[model samples]
Target chain A: TTPLTFREAPEYLTDEKKTPFDAVAKYNNFYEFGTGKGDPAKYAHEMSVDPWSVEVDGECARPGRYALEDLLKPHDYEERIYRLRCVEAWSMVIPWVGVPLATVLSRLEPNSRAKYVYFETLHDPKQMRGQRSLFSTIDWPYREGLRMDEAMNELSFLAIGLYGETLPNQNGAPIRLVVPWKYGFKSIKSIVRIRFLEEQPKTTWELLAPSEYGFYANVNPEVDHPRWSQKRERRLPSGVLRPNWMETRMFNGYKEQVAHLYKGMDLAKFY
Target chain B: MAKVIVFCVALMPLIWLVTDVVLGRIGPDPGQEITERLGIAAFQLLLVTLLITPLKKMTGWPGWLRHRRMLGLFAFFYAVLHVLAFLQLILGWGDLWATFTRRPYIALGAVAFLLMIPLALTSTKAMMKRMGRRWKPVHRLIYLSAIFAWLHFLWQARSDVTEMVVYGLLLLALLFIRAYWFGVSSLVPLRKSRA
Candidate 1:
């Protein structure tokens, strides 16, 4: 693929120091490739991203398979340097190049019945070793979803590239969602299918552990993960001697932009 | 020579970790790398310390007991380092009080390490002699420490319990064998075996 052309979007950018491209590219949690932080960087190259097609169906007026190029054609890509926080309590400020997910979904004409937007990652056990692992509790295709309003949120993004280059397979090649306020897992990787649903579709992690991984995995330090504290996160490239710990913010510090979306709802219950 | 070799082998993980740290090869998150390595080393040492008794009983070998004290102390050493890495390198001292109060797993790990202190301090021959009647009972705290350590790891396990499960099974097996032997040794009269 030719180098992606994207203009820097000032609104989407954060003043936080961007994590080095090497660390962003090398450290990943794309479990389809493998579970280890470095496994995706090592094995993701084996999975083909070219000749990719996204199947958009369910409660959408235009339900069909769109080639990767066609999906990205109408939208001009923008570089969004957003803080990417993982539920595992590690974070990085990543400059992602993509179109707003709302722009893409609006073009698809989601019908009035569409209450939620469901997504599915590419499934091929031959390519994704984790899919074939007997130890994994996740069902294949790695499904995820967002409530319709959440899907339409301005901050929701569809990232195609990072660091002014085409995204490495380890960091979700071809196309992936970038829900900055939510945990990284909510930003599904290697998308192959998207469905506008009438009901909140069950997500992969939520299915594995409903109590821990709820559908709306917005970054909230107030609510702790069942196993560990969410109060703070270690910024990537942090060393033993020179630690880089920071207090986690509500909505990952995007509360001003996204707080209205969850106004009166009890976050702890939803979390 | 055997003790020296055992000590060197036991120290290898820390050496490798320090080398990795100095060389900047400890991956993207050095704090996590150091803490995990030290924690796992402590756990592995704890398992080894438990294994010595079973091996000696099975083989009727007295030589295995010679290295047990050193192995136990090394376990305590790694455990202390693991705690330090978390408090100093990961959480920082400012957040230590809050983290300890809120996080059960971290508190449990601290408890496990604290349980090792008396065992390590009393490991000396002179101290063991002075506490002769109570030495065995006090040293039995290692069992409680093992339980807490395992609990600490288990409570922190997210979805992938593979590592925790493996460690837990090994611990259970070691404890079970000792429990079984404890029963048999009471029935059978003690006899000095060929050294």
Candidate 2:
């Protein structure tokens, strides 16, 4: 695999004012750096992202540590303007430059028993001080899982860059997952390992607060978060004093594409 | 001069928030930033208001009591700002029913604000004179209001409650001191006489 390049996005997707690169780069939930909004920008400099490798194993035909560059060589890339909605009720319209995760997963060649795709983030406490800090509430080496079909969705992207620049450290440097329909946390960051599983992997958030955050965190305005309303989201790159809040769409308005996957499942229960 | 200084000090955060908004210094989500800052300012001012009584008792300074009304009003001021921002910016003053049903933390914030209304309206010397001995009992609502304020903050946190725990401890200590000073200790004048 070799590094892929991104060009112009489709015309229909370019409507929202692109989130200023600085804001996207600066404001993030990469808790690996620290808990505060600006902490990542302040502490991410210490995170070395170059010369990284992702380990692929479990239920796969070819399992080994693959260099970040070689992993991307075979796939075609595109820049898609996506509305990145955070579980915290804030959202940003990002122009993400990357290849589809489906493209990569297919290349890995999952065996007959590969029912689920499990992902894990880097666990180094030295680079990520939050891992070592006693105040952290989340379990480190954060893990997430998606059914094989969900991972193969057309919308499931493996992001490498944003605003045409290589993925910034705070925005999950080198590589990260981008699942537009699901809440942001479902898309894990700074992934170090990926495995094929027959059963669902216990995600970090689900273990921490099961009732609050479900495994399938599909964005639904009707099913409000216990603490805050998801009915409306502050679409970012908004005015400083007054943000224009728009009614949140079910599946963040990606219903036509991804809704078929969860046809009969109780959304409220899954949420 | 101290009155003006205290007033300015309390209002400085609001001023900075407005100035930052104009300059585009706040990040992508300005609504969230403004809302959180207003809420925090309200909480901080309310906490400071509680500090006055203890500080006065420890230092034997009656002057602190004069600024107590202004300080409490500042807390209420921020509370009002916080709610207004939530309504105008976050909720768009739309679907009030939906907001009430879906999000309970907003209710805690609203209840805290409503509790402060009477205290603010009665802050004037005229109302204090009008209420006479009843005024003291009415103003005791601040303790409950402060508790609501803290709960509102604490409930919104998903996890990592280190800061909220600190505030909770501070509020508990203040309430404990008040209960001893005014509740049981006031009636026990015998102890003061013996000392």
Candidate 3:
């Protein structure tokens, strides 16, 4: 693979202390590999990503399959340090190097009918034991979507590497979406397909439990999950005796950059 | 010697957990990991406490019943640790009252823990003798506590409930064995007269 040429974008960097690279690599929720926090790190190494491709189709003029390199070659990369807050009420600050999702979408030339963008993770039961397990209710090839404007938002990134290196297998190697404003699950991992759609796509979590997980899934402290409060999160690497607990911010502290996109829509209802 | 062995064995999980935390072997989220480990240990001990009477009945030996109080107390000990870990490590004691009121799972777990308090307090021989018949009725709350604990786990499950289902079935089997034995013992006089 050709080495990625990228520059750190000061405008995209967050002042918050970044989570240690080891912690970021070890703790993951990639259900494809497994549901356990450490499962991805333990099992992801077996799944291959050296030769990867993404199928981009639906409501786009330039609908076709593109090699991973070709899709990434045209655009320059930028390093953005963003805070990723999971719906489970845990968070981590990560330094990610990637190109903007808009740059890729615009280049694809989405048609007038396109109102939303849908994304899907690679579904291979042989490689991903979690997909083969009867225990998980998640229908394989995990799906996620964003409104067209939300997709075009500057904060919607498609990350390829993190912490100045290509992504670790467990941390969504090859490519993944990173929407800072939304919950970590909204940032789908190990993506294999992208589609522009007219109607909002039914996301994986929403499909499994609609009441608990909604399509928008914007990080909002006011809207509590059915079983737990979203008001606070345990920042990762928390000491057992001295835990690092912080009040969860609306839009995961990306409110200024992404709030205008929601405008008058009810986040509580959407969430 | 037997009681000492039982006591040390019952204390092993807590000892292991503390050692892991100290050694940095508890994983990335030690607070959450510790909280879950303690909660599961408490639940497992509760199941073991429930098993003692049935084992004594099956084997026609009184030895198993001797360890019941100690095991039950250990379950309560773990439950206390679990709740403290959640309160300090996870919640940081922030808006706790609101959390209890809003999250039914937390409320369910709290109810389970609360039910064990009376059992632990009344486990003393003097208190048991004073309470006499009342003691049995009060001790029956353990069944209710087990149910609440199971529900606490069930409600929090996301998508997959296989683990919760297995636990529920195990709890049901234990309860069924006790109820069946109760029915048989209570009918002993009628059966003897008929014979």
Clashes found in each candidate (C-alpha, N, C closer than 3 A)? 0, 3, 0
Over the stretch B1-195, how does candidate 3's per-residue lDDT look in tens digits? Answer: 999998999899999998998888887689888998899899999999989988998999998988999999999999999999998888888778888998888999999999999999999999989987667767878888999999998887775667788899999888888657685333221122211
Backbone clashes in model 2, listed as residue pairs: A1-A70, A1-A73, A2-A73
Q: Any idea what lDDT model 2 has?
A: 0.84
- What is candidate 1's TM-score against the reference? 0.90
- Stretches of candidate 2 off by over 4 Å are A1-4, A7-13, A240-242, B180-195
Predicted candidate 3 versus true structure: per-residue lDDT over A1-271, tens digit per residue: 2356688889888778899998999999998887778889999987899899999999999989999998986347888999999999889999998999999999899999999999999899988878887767888889999999999999999999998888998888889999999999999999999999999999999999998999999999999988778988878877768777889999999888998988899888989
For residues A1-271, could you state the per-residue lDDT of candidate 2 as single tens digits? 1234666547426587877888888898877777777788889877889889999999989899999987885336678889988888888899888888988988899999999999999999889877777756887788998988889999898988887778888888789999999999998988889999998889989998898899899999988777667887877776654666778999989999899999999999988
What tens digits encode model 2's per-residue C-alpha lDDT throughout B154-182? Answer: 87766567678889999999888877777
Consecutive 10-residue window with the lowest summed lDDT within model 3 chain A:
A1-10
lDDT of each: 0.87, 0.84, 0.88
**Candidate 2 CAPRI level:** medium
Worst 10 residues of 2 chain B by lDDT: B186-195
Cα miss at A65, model 2 (Å)?
A: 2.9
The numbered model that scores best in TM-score is 3
Most accurate candidate by DockQ: 3
TM-score of 2: 0.90
